[model samples]
Target: MTSTHRPDLPQLMIDEAVRAALLEDWGRAGDITSQATLPAAARASAVIAARKPGVLAGAGFAESAFRLTDASLQFEPIMRDGDRLSPGDVVARIEGPARALLSAERVALNFLGHLSGIATATSSFADLIAHTKADIVCTRKTTPGLRAFEKYAVKCGGGANHRFGLDDAILIKDNHIAVAGGVVPAIEAAKAFAGHLVKIEVEVDTLDQLKEALTAGPDVVMLDNMQPDQLAQAVEIAGGKVLLEASGGIELDTVRAVAESGVDLISSGWITHSAPVLDLGLDIEIA
Candidate 1:
């Protein structure tokens, strides 16, 4: 985790996302079940509690969901984003018109659980590699509409983010090398084409390619699927002149060894695209 800072999402972004989710869930008639069961004047209080242990994220989304459902809704965040959550922990308290509270429940918990899951998964990877200098990083394989949210969750779990999009950096892969004739031409072309502020990175699978790519001076070189021994050799070859990133086949069980290889960054796509949703539930308090 950033550890010193609280995790946050911009309110405007939260409101926009929650609004779309509400619209999708409500459909044409709006929460018909809640409307039929509860009187307009009826009021209720509810708590969003965790059903499993995890890190907290996306409290902003929960607040926005209830407020957007009905402005009068009182949504109090008992636990902020980046906080550690335990089973049965009360994350938030919601009190308002019964229909509004019930209507927004799913959308609120959906963001909370999904983002928290990514955070939790990231923490698992980060914890094992804490002793090493390498920083765990998340890749671009994120859910289509929720990349920013998922990446934020990664930050909360003590991991860093790679380029948010292709436009930000020049990443030369093997295919790009093939298209450009060789690593030298590809790096030279990227260097010439990219402006002063843009960074260049390239992926290499062998020590020979590493040797060839190093001559071009990329900002970072990704070592794809290299074993810890290979990575150690790559590190020695670079001699701190360029950042070395280890990617491919990284997992919780083997992350420590990868980090110990003396690489600067470990990039994994699984953290964002495949993390399980943390279990959370909203229960109305009888009063």
Candidate 2:
């Protein structure tokens, strides 16, 4: 088994939510097919293996699903979060009642596969910028309630995380700029209104606004929708006066170019919002 410690606090809450979701999925009688076809006393053991190469994540959550279904279930993780695996690599091992395993299989695989996918995608972006000082980060475009888990997966994949919510950091976007009249006014208002502890960041779509944002001296500046040449120019203009973040139009193909532009951080919303779920399965080994 992997020696990495399980995430106690967040994992416990995730377990409770997974259990509730499983309960909702399987009501009074539980999985009807397994109950009808499999004997109650039947025992099974199985291995969770990767069918493709990717980073591992959420193994604990998958184990939680099985344990929540049957406390007697024994789960041994073969890999830790952030561990890169190849096709046919075993991720985890499970031994438990056949019915319990069958009932929990989908929920378990769902969490594991979804999170692993996010981690894999995030890792790709991180790897692209490995040579640069820029850090790959995820934005607030997450799957609602699953943000915490997804962000955790991003970290596991070697990426940094942006603010968790609106409360943590002050981000002044275009709409806020429009409401406040312009970039300078928005940043000025933010600087005046924000607490001393809060770091204020403003998004700019053009070099003119970038110039204005720099004058306001916000903690961070987000360069939105700027081309690679424009980004390099913006970075040069900023001259390390404040942290520069590159956002918008980031994809697997174009990300490396963006990272090479000398920005401090590269934030992509698609890694969490649009990444496809990894293909994984839990097959029973009758014993």
Candidate 3:
């Protein structure tokens, strides 16, 4: 993770997402409570703070929510996306029209909490395998419409992204094997269809399939649901000719063993799909 250089989430990328979220929250009525109670001229200062300790992500998204809600709002960062947080640590400071701040609060925190959750979870898995050559990567099993955002969060938490979508790389899964009639044929089809720049990966469930996959000269082999010993054996069988990825039911306790088994990458869907939301809130002060 590069701390000094924060990852770039361009305005174009964030604007659409943040705008949609804000629109969802606003609906037809548009923060009726704020409109009914607070004067349009009201102004205040607030701080986005951590309610629990975790790694941070989504600084850009959170900022986008606030600014897009009301252009005059001043959002300043005290902490970057990849920074570690403790309870009471302020993530950012905002000063703006009170009603605009209030209206944008939930959308901003939602992005922060959810993305930070993924980042924190990825960090946990990354910590265990740091000593090994393996890297923790996220699967494409991400929340709909939020794949790019979630994958970016994975990077913030010190994990790598597998593929943004099916278009980037060709991963021939077991179903693909069944469709193509066999492992060799699936690999053959993928190789024939893939362009020169695209890498081909095949998912194999057993050592026998691993043997078959290697003959087709795949760039990577996903050893799905295999035990650590089996993975070690597969690594030996490949003889470093193909990159090995151990994926399936990888949790914190077993990740180290998988890493030690000499696989090059460890991927899981849990980090993106099921990670608990990081607790964060905005503390406001009226001006």
Candidate 4:
């Protein structure tokens, strides 16, 4: 089978996203408090410091946040995305007009903290299943507009991405089965309509469903929310006939056990949607 080369994401998209965030904060009168408090010619130097440990992502977006706010601002990244960060580590150094610094600080941290949180959360799951063949994968339960950034964080944390969107693959779920009348019919419909390039996966809730799904020959089978014993049974049934994915209610405590059940992939949504932000601070000094 042939694979398609996906182009690297455009830097312009990150720049425009940063610009939009800045616009949201700036509104009609740009940084009114900063305009009133800081001198027009005053300059400040600052260090972007971490207050918690995490695997970093979104350094480029943070730099874009400051640069898009003011062309004269100096935004430098000392650490790249995927670098492991520790408390008190300096992420970057910035020197610019004081007003610009104050105005851009929150937006920069918003991107850095949120993305780093996702990277860290993914890394935790990846670490738990490191001994197994199962790969940690993130779900589409990402922030509505930030799916690209969140998926990138998953990669940064040593996890793989499943499908970027519904357009990428055919995944027949329980809902589709309900509509189509049965697992076999759903799988058949997907195969009939999907392009040759698209691979089909089916979600099975029980061993009976798994048996039915296997007969239809999907490229992958998802064992949703099954106990370890049931998953082991599914693995035996599959016997390498197709890739198996375990998903639903996956947490750090239970992920390793699920991976040990011999599934090929483990997916979780909380890694991106519910991860707490990493604590980061920008300390400034007037110079």
Q: By TM-score, who's the top model here?
A: 1
How much is 283 displaced in model 4, in angstroms? 0.7
Candidate 3, 66-94: lDDT as tens digits: 89989999999999989999999999999
Comparing 1 and 4 by TM-score, which wins? 1
Return the TM-score for each candidate structure: 0.97, 0.95, 0.96, 0.95
The pairs that clash in candidate 1 are 1-158
lDDT of 2 by residue, 10-76 (tens): 6677887798879988989789999999999998999898888898888888888989999998999
Candidate 2, after superposition: displacement of residue 162 in Å? Answer: 0.8
Candidate 4 runs further than 4 Å off: 1-8
Alpha-carbon shift of residue 101 in model 4 (angstroms)? 1.5
Count of residue pairs whose backbone atoms collide, per candidate: 1, 0, 0, 0
Candidate 2 ranges with C-alpha deviation above 4 Å: 1-9
lDDT of all predictions, in order shown? 0.92, 0.87, 0.93, 0.90
Instruction: Report the Cα lDDT for residue 143, model 4.
Output: 94
Candidate 4 — which pairs collide? none
Q: Order the candidates by TM-score, highest first.
A: 1, 3, 4, 2
State the TM-score for model 4: 0.95
